[model samples]
Target: MMASIQKRPNGSWRARYRDDEGKEHARHFDRKIDGQRWLDGVTAGMVTGTYVSPAAGKVTLTAFYLIWAERQVWETGTRRAMDLSVRSCSFEGVELRALKRSHVESWIKAMSAAGLAPLTIHGRVRNVRSVLRAAVRDRALSVDPSEGVSLPRKRRADMAMDIPTPEDVRRLYDGAEDWFRPVVALAAFAGLRLGEVNGLQLADINFLPRTISVLRQVQRTPGMAIEIRSPKYGSERVIPVADSLLLILSAHVENVGVYGDDNWILPGRDGGPIWPRTIAYHWDRLTARLDLNGVRLHDLRHFYASGLIASGCDVVTVQRALGHRSASVTLNTYSHLWPNADDRTRSASQSLMDGALAIPADSLRTAGA
Candidate 1:
């Protein structure tokens, strides 16, 4: 093992070293102490024969990224997105170790200027940062320049466009396909998530008790593959169904061909488990047919919450029905659904003034006049 210090023309200090394979590595530092600290760490690694120089500075950024991608086992849709991002930018012949903070900042700016959504930009930047973090852990560089970089803040769109009112849900259900109408009803009335709805089995429903047991969820992968997973956060819950919904569910089970004890309640036409996307597709068709504007399938759950709040259900109760991790989330998201107290306050104030002014005239005359 060999170590040396050199001063660059740019006035930065560089610590150079050679490993057992005679491969040379260099890391630049802004201060002499920093350079010496890096050299000490290298010396210790050399002594233990555990030194593996990332040698990223010697390879082009494009080549390094290809190696990184080989180690990533991204799901189908995520792989496509990663590929698009990698291909969209040109990092050819750029040394990985020499990557500066400005390079990353400029790339982010360019992505934003390209009219990409803030969320999309945030995801891409996060992916890039993950790769860089691995490189740092591998001792590819002295420091990670991408660290502490901030991406554009994401702006949440108005919830009104996404959440549907009870009337809108009723209209959607009226136009939905026979097999899907009850699904919408369950979502709006019972607050079951799409996955929970898809994962339901005939055995999990109790028509007499008017309650449904949520045990698992069916989700679709990026390539449209379907699988059943546990509910979000893996918490099993039971929610009570209204009398009307219980009756509808009972009829739906008989009409749709009752399933075996192990079969799902809402299976695809092939008799396999239903995918969430299939539900979304059916929802789109139903909304279009009914001319219901600005409503998504997930909005049905919002309708459920709004209905409960409008019916005088407390926040904690709504949170339980929606399977929200916390009551605060339910309150923050649907607080506007509850009536404003301003009107009540104004009316109380007016009543107080009237009562004060109309204090019986005979009593006032006896006391003062």
Candidate 2:
């Protein structure tokens, strides 16, 4: 039942509301009209399904967000990114119900002003919105303040992967230890992601067919367990190995003895697959040592794409080689990297004119005459 108001013997109004458990709350008001207004608001809140114990607003956004985050199953890298975004959030301490669109807007402005990239800011805003949306769903909040807040438009920098030059890749490849050389070469040449690279075994490579089959990927769960999962976007594909890369892989295979068909190519000390962060940790140190700034291990795949574009591979070829779900994904990432595209267009146009019909011959003969 909704709340009711009654006039006490002292001519004051006593407004009482019952909780779900039959507990009652009373407020003494100076005027009956004020009591009626309060009761009407309670009824309206009930109608809108926004009625909650008044104490619900006392839960802070940060406290509740932690609860929400804990229950989500996220990739380790994504979890780290979300953790960083939430740690830097300035508005997490606000009461869940008291958060306003204005507060969210101001936070966005502050974050943008702090010089974070649009993509990074977008991720941060998304994290906050995810929690606020959950709060609204669970009835701790009446509405999500993040609604109607503007987010950054994704640009090439946000959507496209950055590529490193062949020289930069060669430098890292040459500088890496022998144990890591095959890992670096395959990632740079075959366009395999770190997870896919880590999940490889001796049986996945084919010498006569000159192809390497990508079937599985390794990932670390939120609980720190090393698990084998399908490749990102489930991109199961066979990638042909360049002869040079095949030689490097052969050498790597020969050197790392004690291999079975199912054994990991790059196994951890525990004789299982290594975490992707382990690769990142070594890559971070190697890049620093080689003075290759802003280059990541993932950019090796971009380097591979760059090579394909330079070799005059079409969009569809690169898409399939990269195991992308669609050709547009390949174009979106490396459209700018296609070598001599403008020159080829100009050359093709000139060639078309050169092979055109000889309509001007009669006019030229008349001019000579």
Candidate 3:
């Protein structure tokens, strides 16, 4: 659309143009050149398919989030976490158009100053970036201001994972109540997540084939009832049962009594599935009673992973056993546990040389003469 400049009655220049929607926007300037420059930029944006309506981004981040969040298909737990992340960033009142890199950097600094972990600060920033990115797609903002902002580095020690010792697992198992022993076994031996264990049913276990099928997980949100959902994306798998674990599960069934094939394998005291919070409460009490400090229930899964790596399982095998979505995920988490590639290469070369250079006993005796 062609922009027009005119001299206003007050001796100022007015630059006006009609947008694609036929809406007229006018700006007054002290000089004709300045008005022309503004009009040129606006038209250029339109020509480049980058035009954003001046009034579209008037809504604050908080207001836009309310509308945008309603349209998202996230699970209850995910939605709750997303809301918390958005609130933690403290950018609710900032308008989408007014959001700047400075605002994002300042929030990161404030969160760092408040002693929040670098991972947590990054998460909050990522959540806010999601909203801003959506605004860009909706034409509420011409660009996402959160892009390219520097984030705090996570400490190396914080990224390190520790596997629980066998003694630690045995102590927890022996000290735990009989009913809770199965929970410990499932995590430490089978590598089932706490949620997956909570969601297990008698039907999911195959005693004939000695395999356990992981199909679902129990998730909880504050002020909401527990929901059984599909296992975390690509986590649905069947793990082959080791004889030791099979024996433990067999004993558990005989001693605990099978309520029904459809019933929960580990039900609450009231015959319902165990709540995550309740499990956490019991686990904390048990750990403290045993004086096992710095040991988390999740560590049991790491123990299982370490075991797989120690047994010479290949990357793809371990990935499938642990229900990881990709081999890269398995490698990233447990690469340290695997033997060094250089060591393997050296050992293989030595074996090859030994076979190729073998000498007969007669030859050895002649050499001695």
Candidate 4:
């Protein structure tokens, strides 16, 4: 072991040692003998193959986050969120080896105190934890410092049904230009997400069956090109179209300037897929022109589900139409929109109570006879 001891002007001794990789590490001691003893332990640890490289954990948090982000394969939007989390983090020069549960808790508390939305804080904290996890996987630490640390719970996004009423939908559709009318129609009537509506190809539509084959969707992930991936929750399902929607879609396919069967039904100027963003911008302007506020592109989907539930569609039917992962997911989102639950409960109770009170018709007749 090539280790050295130096005496400081303040009468403290310092021991320096190099690991197998020639990285130098040092410890301070009150006496020369203590410094020598510390070096001995390091040398012994190296010989026993129990050596932990301090270099891994000594990396700055910002540096490690950059390294970790490069290897991540999250979609563009999610990747951007992760990148923002790291960029906006306060632990600029914090050392990974010195990270502790207290540090994580302090960060969580600080974020909570800053009045950030619970979901945003949760995502940022999760991104930080995942970076530390990568360090652990790299053997920088024996235990995850983030393990068992309390993080803010993620509150679900507001999926409330602030839908455009039927009249509003008509006004918006009527205002849309020729190229965008079908897009509006699909969003308002078919409840297709922005990506799904943009990703539709002519072959995916079946006029005879009056259904849309939702095989893929356009997503803008971190890379240069927009990705075509399965729908949210990785669900691939067919959604039946209402007659009015089917007719509009049929007319669009026949008359509107759509890309060919193999291409995006709604193609951009360059003859490829139209960006969901561009479509959203159009919708934004249209909604503003029509004086519709607090309406999101996703609200169109909620409108479809709410309408269905009000019209007595069951949870499974809604789940399939929305392409959610499960019926529970559908119910959790729109259960409040279900109509007449109190009335249904009253009717059921009334029937049961009436049955309990009634005497058999034949029993009174037999007694009289």
Candidate 5:
């Protein structure tokens, strides 16, 4: 049924109506004709079932994002990255359902115009797509406006393959602080990611057999909240502990004591989880002291892979050690580090020549005959 207009004591005319979902809304008009005009429109919409309240049509982009962020299930670091991307987005206050493909395309263009990298633009688009997809699933919108949006082709940056020469690594380690040196050695020799290193517990170490178990990772969100999560794919694998790292771990445990039954191998000064930035800061200081190229802490993982390839370890073994889900990932990432097999063609050519040319010194003398 349609609603009727009523005059209030304040002398304003108000029209009341119920939506399809049985929710009531009232609109106040200054003129009786205006209220009657609105009531006529509402009565027509009710008869045709086409009435969409202004509030429903007017949901701001910011409100939709807040709802989306609340329901998101992501790791701390990933969530933080998404939040940052949303905060930096240009379409913050536009009506969400009113968004169009051109609007999304223009937003991407604006980001590129601001000199953001293609990968960064791609990430922002992905975040927007995720929110829009959720909106579609919730029936808030009939379709995702971000669908079919095209992104610029990403240009691959020059990867950091300039791994420290063995000499440089030795010098860096020697100059590192006593407590920090072990962390560097573990990263370089064992190829542990920063989160893995911070997540290590005493039980994860096998002092007797010299092995380390990779099971969990620790990450910090934007507000410095710590979250521990299972390794990618929940992979739990054992890596052989290098002799240098084992020795360092032993001494570190002895000096620090077990701390707690929780068994964290590396804790903060007051026995909480260690900060990832603290490790990177110390690593940078060590590199500066050694006057080496400013290698990223993650690059140490690359250094470990390069060392293995250089030392004749096959890609499969390296893949397992690094806990990569696929051998192709390992191969693609480290393929440039592998020596080129094309250089070996000369050796095969010499063997073929030796077999084909049967002429000796005596045969050469008889060639004129």
Candidate 6:
């Protein structure tokens, strides 16, 4: 039923309505017109399915988050990140209905002032925005306060991808522990992400065809056991293994027999897939020992991509080889590494001119006089 307006004994008007849950909400207004207007708005909101019970708005952001988070279908790592992001801010105690754009903007300003990286601030802002959006969907909020909030921009230096040289990769390969060498080889030779490397299994490697099939990846969230999941969306692919990389894998297999049920190339303690943290432990030791500061294991993937670009591979080829979702992603990251259009055009013209001139042409000398 629609809201009812009544003339009160004190000459004011009372507007009252029963919510979907049969809870009554009432407001006293100075005039009958005001009460009717309020009732109309309440009716409209309810008709449009946008009505929020007066008490629902009283729930704090923290309380709402606790309720909303449990219903989300997120990966464990994603949930952990979201939890950390929520805890990083002070606005959790704010009531959902009381949250204002200024409050969100102020939170962003505080994070920026604290010298957080633009990416980190952006991530937290995104997480908070998601929660606020959910509140709107659940009718706890009329609007998302975090909408249209500007964030700090990433500097050029922060955006630059640091690709290690082949010599640096060779040094890293030589310095790594014998068991960890295959990790480096897979990353440097085949552009596999760390999780993919850790998820590698002997069955995924086809010795006859010399191809590495990236099918799955190992994921870990704090306080949870490592779990195996499919590769990052659209990143499942098969990379043709180079003979050298194949030799490294062969040697590793010979050194450590692959006899497990899962046939994990780099098995964890229980002879299942190795955890990413274990790989990180070995990687930290190797990098620290070699004094290769700031050179992460992911840099090897960049090194692999750069090598493919240097070898004249096209954007699409590199995209597929690197298991990127699309060529645009490949170009955006490695466009600078590709040869310039002007240089390629000039080289092609010069080669064509040389070939044409190579055909000796006898000069016409007045009928061979």
Write the residue-wise lDDT of candidate 6 on 144-256 in tens digits.
88889899997553257788888889999999878888899999999999999988888888889989999999988666788888787548898887988988999999997
TM-score per candidate, chains pooled: 0.65, 0.69, 0.87, 0.68, 0.67, 0.83
Q: Best to worst by lDDT, what's the order? A: 6, 3, 2, 4, 5, 1
* Runs off by more than 4 Å, candidate 6: 18-24, 43-51, 157-159, 233-235, 259-261, 309-369
lDDT (Cα) of model 4: 0.77
Residue pairs clashing in model 5 are none
**Candidate 2 regions with alpha-carbon error over 4 angstroms:** 1-3, 14-29, 32-55, 76-84, 105-118, 150-161, 170-178, 206-247, 255-262, 274-294, 306-369
What are the per-residue Cα lDDT tens digits for candidate 3 across 1-369?
Answer: 867999999999999998878888899999999999999899887877667778777888888888999999877776887898788766778887788889888988999999998988878888889988988888788888889999999755325687789999999999998878988999999999989989888888898899999999987867777877887764899999788887887888789855534578775536667788778888999999999868889899999989988888899988888889899988878888888989799878767867898655468679968
Model 5, span 112-175: residue lDDT tens:
8899988889988898788777666654554677888889877533363557667877787788
- The numbered model that scores best in lDDT is 6
Q: CA lDDT of 237 in candidate 3?
A: 93
lDDT of each: 0.75, 0.81, 0.85, 0.77, 0.76, 0.86
Residue 209 Cα positional deviation in candidate 5, in Å, after optimal superposition: 4.1
Candidate number with the higher lDDT (2 or 6): 6
Model 2: per-residue lDDT, tens digit, 229-256?
7777678999988888878888887886
lDDT of 2 at 219: 78
Of candidates 6 and 1, the better by lDDT: 6
* Native-referenced Cα lDDT, model 5: 0.76
Candidate 1 Cα deviation (angstroms), residue 144: 5.0
| Candidate with more favorable, higher lDDT: 3 or 6 | 6
Question: What TM-score would you give candidate 3 relative to the actual structure?
Answer: 0.87
Candidate 3 weakest ten by summed lDDT: 154-163
lDDT tens readout by residue for model 4, 1-369: 679999999999989988777778998999899998888877776676444577776888788778777887765666777778777677747887777777777877888899997777877888877877777666565456667877776644344247668887777788887778888777777778888887888888888889888888887665566777777667778889888887787787677757744666786646678887788888888778878856777877877887888788999998998889899888778877776668799868767866997756567689977
Query: Count of backbone clashes for each model?
Result: 0, 0, 0, 2, 0, 0
Off by over 4 Å in 1: 1-96, 127-150, 157-161, 222-225, 233-236, 259-261, 308-320, 323-369
As for candidate 6, its clashing pairs are: none
